[model samples]
Target: MTLLFLHLSRSDYKNFLNFMTELSYQCNITLHQSDIFSFLKEETYDLAIIDAFNPCSFLVIEKLGIPFIAFCPGLFINAGRVGIPGPLSYVPEYKSSLTDRMDFFGRLKNTLAFMVSSVIVMKMDALFDQVIDEHFPAGSRPTIADLHLKPELWIYNVDFSIEFSRPLLPNVQWIGGLLTKPAKPVTPELEDFIAESGESGFIVVTLGSMISSLPVEEFLKEMNDGFAKMPQKVIWRYDRSDWPEELNVAHNVQLVDWLSQNDLLGRVFVKHAFGVGTGVPNLSLNHKAFTIEQAKHWCYQTWKKVAPQLSYMSGVRDWVDQRK
Candidate 1:
């Protein structure tokens, strides 16, 4: 079988390749990764996997005359096109953080968000059409709306645990954290530091990639003050060496240029805000401090269900065979 993978971010491209490589050992599969822009008409494939977030690229896959799968790295946003209710009533928008159940205000807000999202999608589809018309002859390709309505499978990189309950199409699948992996080995210095902390242990502070670069002098000052009084050691992942001289870091708090976050999460305690990568399997900090016992049940439950090994391929395999 041949596959066309299109419009993925650099990180996702590497990850997609890893999945395909493993599949190669099990079956004969020809893959094409690049040069898709100019060769959409000339080349062909048994199936295509297009990034759902990149709606413009959807045009090329629609013109390929083959079955395709919509791969969403995070939450799937094409709910309207697929006849699925979204960000409305029970379904929560990623930003809203509401569960399937909602209050009257929550429902109203979700409906508004859903409407706004639909308008944005419509505008994006118009732009996609313009580009398609330039590349292919007029009336040669299907309109974005028509293409979007075609029956297809959608893979969401999220699960129902954190997400609110919602109806999904028969072809839709939830494979959240399928790519999760075990923490890498910790460095000798980090190992020694943790060992020295003894029963007190350590807390990891990271804003992750999305917020780490923002200018938050006041935020840092507040954090400095908070960690100084804490008894447990703190490992702060701040790359900047020249911290403001006014803020005095406590002896217990150590600043590092970087740290293996996944590795650190496995070893120590963390309490973070709801941002970029916070919903993964871990403890959610309630108060200023929490006992390991609070997180123990969650950690154990998550490990049993979502152990580092990848396991989201069965649906793809079944879909491919059915299409063939």
Candidate 2:
């Protein structure tokens, strides 16, 4: 079966391409990445997975009148749209540190944030509609607001277990860890580092894919100072080869160009995992915070959830059939 994949920007396209390349190898799949409107006109597709971040592509796919599925890498945006509870009380918006159980003021902040985000999305959706109308004839296409609610299924990169309890439609599925695989063998350097650390153990730091270099020098200095004071060593996966002299003074900290994040997470580390903006506390402590141990727990749990959903050939035949 042929699948048509569409992403808006170059960076997103490259990131998705990497995953799709590996996916194509496992399944006998013919993938199309050319112009969506033209390709949709000339070809027959068993499925079309469009990036939800790019509403323009979603509008174009809607014009073709084909049944399509949406893939959102961010937090769930369709919860309120799909008749679920609003983010005002129980639910928290993306980047909002508020947990599921919120007080009166926290709920007020969440409601305001939700309304603002919704307005922004509505404006963007209108812009996407205008772009589609410019390309196609006036009366040929529907507005993005009308078509945004038409997807057969929406696969979010988040888990219901981690999120607040809410009513959800049958079309929504949380395929968060469907892409994760078993960790491969780490390099010799990492092996040596792990061995040298011994009982002390080393902490691994990564700010996900979007962040390459540190944002501020003061922050780096503060981190270096903290690392120097700590007893355990640190292995930071940073993009920069040259670090500040102040940071280099801390011999305990080692910066590498890259590291196997999943491999590192699989191993034992401190219960708390801290990032620039996020602080995760493990379940052993408090469940409200985000911790490396909690992340590891969720990662393994997601794998277990995903494995049973996969067919013998690594295809999501079970999940697809569940739509019926």
Candidate 3:
């Protein structure tokens, strides 16, 4: 059987490649770096693993006629108002924003419209012919549909021991942090810096791959000030040319062009923290305010919501260690 990995970013590609290599199952593997749509026309895949963030994957699945898996960082369920629960869900509505964005009156109108549309699409005579028993099993059967509707599946990635509060579907697996192995070794300068910082621990700041080069000098300055007050060492992952001079002299700070984030965060001393523009809170109140922003654009408002906190470092560390 041929297993095709689709729609992965560069970092994700690295992780997926490593995981596939380690797996005992023998299958033909092909990697496509471009968008799933472009790749779909050229080839066919037996099984597809897709990032849920890319909604277009759903369309691809319909074309490919394969049982595929969807992966997401977090599933936003409607809690109260605009608030979403911490856990992820596989609800189709959640995947689409049709209902989530409708106003109160508009929601009511849309609900009626949806019911009418459903009746037309699913004919009354067809209901009786449908085999419900085949889809919904007696007792308990591990099914994606069941897990998608219910958040209790408690599934998580294997490489990282990041557990879910609820149960998860048997088929919905996690192999997130497992792909890449450790790098050679930390340089002497970096090693010495970590050693000199005593027991207060260190802080590691990275904004993932896409926006690592964006100019955020003012925001970085604020972060530098925040770190300056804390009694911890700071390791800022920044491009050397973009490094701000004001932050260079601090004895407590170590600036590098790039560091192995997964490895560094695994270390005992490194704490993870991210900075956002002052306008973060306001943006949360209005989700549609920045629709035109590019995927790589770093809006302080959006970053604040998705950004990891320093306290989450322990949880992330524990997750990684468990994978080992």
Candidate 4:
């Protein structure tokens, strides 16, 4: 959590500049060599399973001289690092918000996004120059991008069944929904709340933890009023303690700090989230979009077919043994 550097300049590059600034100041700055790094140099390791989004981990690879697996925890975070063969014509830019079914203008925007994102990534990588120079000899210094490509395998936390179909590299693999648990029945309290709505099913609202609370009181009032009009009971992930004491709670809405997303994924789903894998396509086998049952079938099939073979091919089973 300690910051070693925090420097940023206003630029005409817009979002790319903001991204580079936030990344450098908030994340990478603290990765500078310390006693922990000294301890790392003295220890021998079999393999490094890296959180690819944290480019700082590249320093660990440099120090350890160990084989690695580039593990991307989010579906599209720093997606281009592994070079997964996303053609701009069909594959939308990471954060450009364009769909696979793009018109000419959408294609142009996606292309531009790709170019801007590339420049941003390169600049962000270069920010490690100071640390790299101080830690290693000039002849031995490696480009951050080079270290990224050196990973023996790349694993993304994504389900291809609910994503746009794209060609993938041989080293790349998908293992999303691996952590998903079977849906459990809703508790009696939640059941009673939904039953009060008669035939109208409940609406689940989770604004994500990042920007959960509304700062503007008026905006909160307006939003609260809008939710009040809905006949369906609302199960919102809003901390009750954070609620404004001045405002009245919506009669139809049930405020909660958390809810089981897996337990409630049935009937009809209106998914709203800001992420690459979750959006777009929500697609599956044969390009059929929004067929949950078929998607589940294909996802299960992929798991059954790929899991056994992948362990053998990637040597994950042996690697795990080495770790143990």
Q: lDDT: which candidate is best? A: 4
What tens digits encode model 3's per-residue C-alpha lDDT throughout 219-299? 455445555665667786767677666655356777788787645654323221121222211111111111112111222
Supply the TM-score for candidate 3: 0.43
What digit string (tens of lDDT, one per residue) describes model 1 on residues 211-289?
4432556645555665666666778777666677666777777778788776876433444322223344332332211
Task: List the RMSD of every prediction in angstroms.
Answer: 15.0, 14.2, 15.7, 13.5
Q: Pick the candidate with the highest TM-score.
A: 4
Tens-digit lDDT track of model 4 for 56-123: 67666767778889877544445566666788899765545455678999998877777776766667
Residue 36 displacement (Å), model 3: 8.6
Q: What stretches of model 4 exceed 4 Å from their correct place? A: 1-19, 26-29, 38-45, 73-80, 87-92, 95-113, 134-137, 209-212, 216-219, 267-324
The lDDT of model 4 is: 0.59
Q: lDDT per model, in order?
A: 0.54, 0.53, 0.39, 0.59
* Estimated TM-score for each candidate: 0.57, 0.62, 0.43, 0.66
Better of 1 and 2 by TM-score: 2
Lowest-sum lDDT 10-residue window in model 3: 280-289
**Candidate 1: which stretches are off by over 4 Å?**
1-50, 57-68, 85-99, 102-113, 124-130, 141-152, 181-184, 209-212, 241-250, 255-258, 266-324
For candidate 2, give the lDDT of residue 74. 35
